[model samples]
Target: MTGVSFHEFRITDSQRLDFHYEIDSETEKKTGEIHFQSNIPIPFDPDSVALALSTMCGSAYRRVRMDLRVSPRARKVVESFLRCELSAPARGGVTPERRRRGNVLSFSGGFDSLAALRLMPDDTNLVSMDFGGRFSTEKPFFDKFRPTVISTNIVGTDFQRNSWSFMGIGAILTAPIHAAKYMTFGSILEAGVDNLRRLPLTSRGQTFPPFAGAGYRNAPYVAGITEIGTAMILVTYCPEVVNDSLASLALPGEEKLYRKYVLASIAAERAGLTVDLKEPPPPATRRPFGRNFTADFLSLYIRRFGGAQVRDAFLTDVPAEIDALSERLALTFYERINTTIMQKFPVELAGGLYERAAVAGLVPYTEDDWREYMIVRDALAPYHPTVAR
Candidate 1:
């Protein structure tokens, strides 16, 4: 891989942010531009610009030397990842600036996002990225408010979506970091259940959350911990922006009945929004993951292998963590998660962190673990499987 040179970036008159760059080779010379379009002009933030470019570049290049400004942390993270993961080197020269304002909600006008929108202050900057190129002005999700909607047809590229995990990360990175105080992603507690329930039936072990990055609350974007590694990198490098998820904040319990009924009751009573099955589509996506599971494989792997730094990087202080409902719900979730894995996967293939790590010599465990594992694996299954679609 050759070094990627980023030429001057400019917001075109057509509201497109363009990065002009070239790759020189013995066989031929290659030139290209990475474009992000917004109906509104995107204010330039060097750190944001660098972060977006690096994210789009992925781990393919040997060296990424860009002229744009970057935060020290952003520069450090990119250099660290390239060196450690890709064995590549990265260098940049740039200064930081306070170029953004107010919380920018990745509003999709769905149950989770709408619920989130209701919770935010009226003045919060609501932004919807048309990553899928499905942006329609007539869509119901946009009818409620006039927001700064940024739409793009970039998802069809290998650099963007070839790897399933990178999709969400790409969508998040497209955000106008220059104008955001905090960046909020729309994820729900059901997302956690979906991931845990859909734990891969293979030897891959616990995986990162399939839909959202390891369904953690207010998790800072650390390179290896979260599922969508880029988001963690963005938030980590740009301290000016906070990574938040209202769904993670509001729906801590993993109970389906409670989340669907009880939590709805709570949100409706508290937020004054309608909570029911027959509702309009959310501004983001109406139908989220129906059958896929999100896992915290990286975090669990670190807990076993990377020691305290990695563990602490992914951990957070969950406010009140759980309640009576959540406590019972959690117990039920644990018992059911094990049983579900067993039923859907071979018993030999169903174990999570403990069993998988023990077999691989990554962690130490004994026969005592089997009894506890069986309790969840063989116990009478509790929660009934719901129709995710």
Candidate 2:
């Protein structure tokens, strides 16, 4: 990975917002602009907008620089947002008006997000975004609140790596447009945090500390600095949804819904409809909703090594030594990265990433757990680099 530069962000007189960025690496030099068409008038502060966009895309580069001057406040926010991986000039203060239109759920109609929607107050506004070329549908009831539909026009590519880079952060960026008080995601705390505890070495990348903790810091920094609050609704629901066995816990509020589902199940049984809760969700014939390429890449790499291998390594090698197994499994996972494409999320897989996650006060992991995955990832690998990271 080389340097990535942010050139400019402009809202054209034609109600189009444009973002210009360039990536200069040894293998490839690419430059392009992203155009966002807005039907409703939305105020934007150029520096803040540039910072947000740059941070979202800057993960690919070792160095990130902004051509436009940034206010001191915005610079601080950006530093916090990207964990000080970016560079930009700093001046004085410039604030945008925070929307008073109450909370907005960044809905994706996914299981987790839908669960969050059910948990939220009925009046909470729903704001949906479609990146990777998916388009959000308009709901007539939401018209009064001026529901937002963001189309990034990017469906798939090497750059179309992480959905959060666009979808998650993009929702925060829309706060000003929606006059949104809090931009919430359906990120369930129980699934992510519990998954981390149950499978620390093999948990999903986002479930790890550096990435998850960022939710606590980054979103709020962006929202507060931009004059709105950030919401990680799933974190709130974790205690209510997961149990000690690392399985899904029934939500008290959903008991009635569950009963109804049970009755429907009985009806389906009487009608001879094939229904089996033990079976997995049907394989996606079409691209699954909100599919993230980067996560997919990491998951495929992990699955290639066999997720069960981590535990097997533990059972076979360090049956009586939990600490030894923890460190060994961490190193094993790290070494696997040395031979795979999971290197992209280097920092997230690093020891520091998990260490930071440990202190995040979410779910608990043994302090002895190891995570030098990034250090190992940066080391020599046998394959050629198709795209710089």
**For model 1, the run of ten residues with the poorest summed lDDT:** 216-225
- The sequence of per-residue lDDT tens digits that candidate 2 reaches over residues 1-389 is 67767667677763467767787888998787766654555554455365446436635557778766766655555555554465766656556444254456666543344444544445766665555322222222223345565556544533456334555544445555545444455443222212212233332333222222222212111110000000112222332221110112222233212322232233234334444332122222322211322222232223233343422221222123333333344432311111121122333223432233223221222233124433322221112122213
Error of 1 at 54 (Å): 2.5
**Highest lDDT among the candidates is held by which one?**
2
TM-scores for every predicted model = 0.44, 0.48
lDDT of each candidate versus the true structure: 0.38, 0.39
Looking at model 2, report the run of 10 residues with the lowest lDDT sum.
221-230
lDDT computed for candidate 2 = 0.39
lDDT, residue 366, candidate 2: 28
